[model samples]
Target chain A: MTTQEPTNAENWAKPVDSLHIAHDLPDHAINLNVEGKRVASMTSGFGKMWQKTYRVRLDGARVAPQQVVKVWKEHFPEFWQKGQHFFGPMASISPGDVALINVKTGGVKLSTGILVLYADDVSFSFMTPEGHMFTGMITFSARELEDGVTQAEIVALVRAQDPIYELGMMTMGSGAEDRQWLHVLRSLAAHFGVEGKPTLEKICVDRKRQWKRFGNVRRSAAIRTVFYSVTRPLRRKEKTRASA
Target chain B: MDFSADVRQIDGLAVIDLHGEIMAGADDALTSGFVRATTGNTGPVLLNFADVSYINSTGIALIVGLLAEARASDRRILVSGLTDHYKDIFEITRISDFVTMCDDEESAAAAAKA
Candidate 1:
């Protein structure tokens, strides 16, 4: 094949030097941890890297890849189960947009955020920030197979960001993450009036952990989110006085 | 689209000749080529991107996976022939931090030797 560059190749999200949370939106339980942190790549993580894929074959729905992607991007938050919140400024995913996420787990609320890393017609991806549970990227895509079946898939290439996160993953963190996506796919399939049975495939891409990244614990979101939750009443009192 | 990688040795450096669009289904082939590139060598591996016409974010992540492998084995990776646009993507992802960038194969190979 010749080496001609793609003409008007689809628009990808622009590169960002770091993460900055948009503060114009209404304050929520998960908004505190994301305001000033920089996005973290897989190399910034402290644990072994793993790639987990969750896919649902949308057979009998006759949905094209573009259609699936269109709906997925526009209504991403609606598909999540109750109590898992995702708020993005744009109606669709774009490069450099930041999405705030607050997930409830183990009777505690965990606040974190994602930076929109890339977006195109058929796919989009998010990169995690420092202090998030996973430091890596999650790509959601829809494509038609050779057999003419359209499949929607989410691939998470992640590693724990610190020792605390690694321990959480070993205990219940990974399971919670898995169930959330499962709920999302099922909900999406249901919206299209198709029964979606998603299958999971996990691969341990790298076995060695970066012990040097143990310092990541200093920026742990879980710990900081807890602090914010504890100090919420004081903030509310201050706001009341300013209003008076 | 299909992606293929051909690994060739030049003065103890491995140069992977990459071709085609990089996206969802190209993971296995790239890994196979990377394994071949590192065999019987402890020196640097330089990727020849002269023929690579496109790369998505997933493709970038795939390259990061390879870089992680290279780092684990204590070998540096280099890239040559990336158009300015994709080179910008590398800068955005901060992948340029771990891998050395060059304009062409000759310069990359020279850097590998030095």
Candidate 2:
């Protein structure tokens, strides 16, 4: 076993003017709300900031931390719940890759994407882009505990991107977000033949909302998705008439 | 390289000199240094990354957490001595949007005074 020095700088993605999803995704993967969008961080969000952690310890699984992370990155999308679709890039989950996401929540389908900000042997992270439901970063990691247990964890530090998203978070969006990650962890553990029960910890980092960011609603992905869905028939008809 | 943080006062500013590869294990030292620098201090805190060798995603998140703490308390944070590469990383993460980035400790002190 060789311990490699962490070349952190090289592992990070180069700075981009805006996100561009270069990956060719499946037909089911909606690529909206991603291209030409800037990556949004905690400072650009509208609602109160929160740091959420979901952890699942592979109790009886015989896997090293690095092995767990490798598998997690390789099968990244496979762990997602049924309604959520993750379309990874051709090169897999490397840093700077842009992946499309199609999520179905409460019977409403929305499209968004994330920038793979950083990736290493034992961990990786993603940063949300503009018009995303939240403005933040989520890190996935696997580490060996003191008792020799390999623990897989997901940590999200985020804030709602706009007032509408904030309201939804206050209602059903927050629980849905929680369940999504929890399900992913459970599924990952189950993939290793372990029935892992995930634990969650939520902490509010900041109580004050950034009212200035309320204008971010102008780029709301949910609204755009709804509009796209409602006008699909009209677009199809126009295309047919033009071809005729 | 292991992470180490030393907090000191320079011209009324709490300047934390960080040395090492900042990864997951850096949470304790980083958080303690931040708390030590900001406790009872009304002025902006300067983080000097002149000697930093590496910084992973976890390290970035730790810095973001510190920034959140500072913002919550109405305090400011200024960063200095980041290599051009790290400067770009900060920009990509949008940490540059909230904190002032300086070329060196001297400039960071001057910015804090400003």
State the C-alpha lDDT per candidate: 0.83, 0.89
CAPRI quality band, candidate 2: medium
**TM-score of each candidate's B chain against the true B chain:** 0.96, 0.97
RMSD of each: 2.7, 3.3
- State the displacement of the C-alpha of residue A184, model 1, in Å, after optimal TM-score superposition: 0.9
For each candidate, what's the DockQ? 0.45, 0.51
CA lDDT, candidate 1, residue B55: 91
Candidate 1 has a TM-score of 0.92
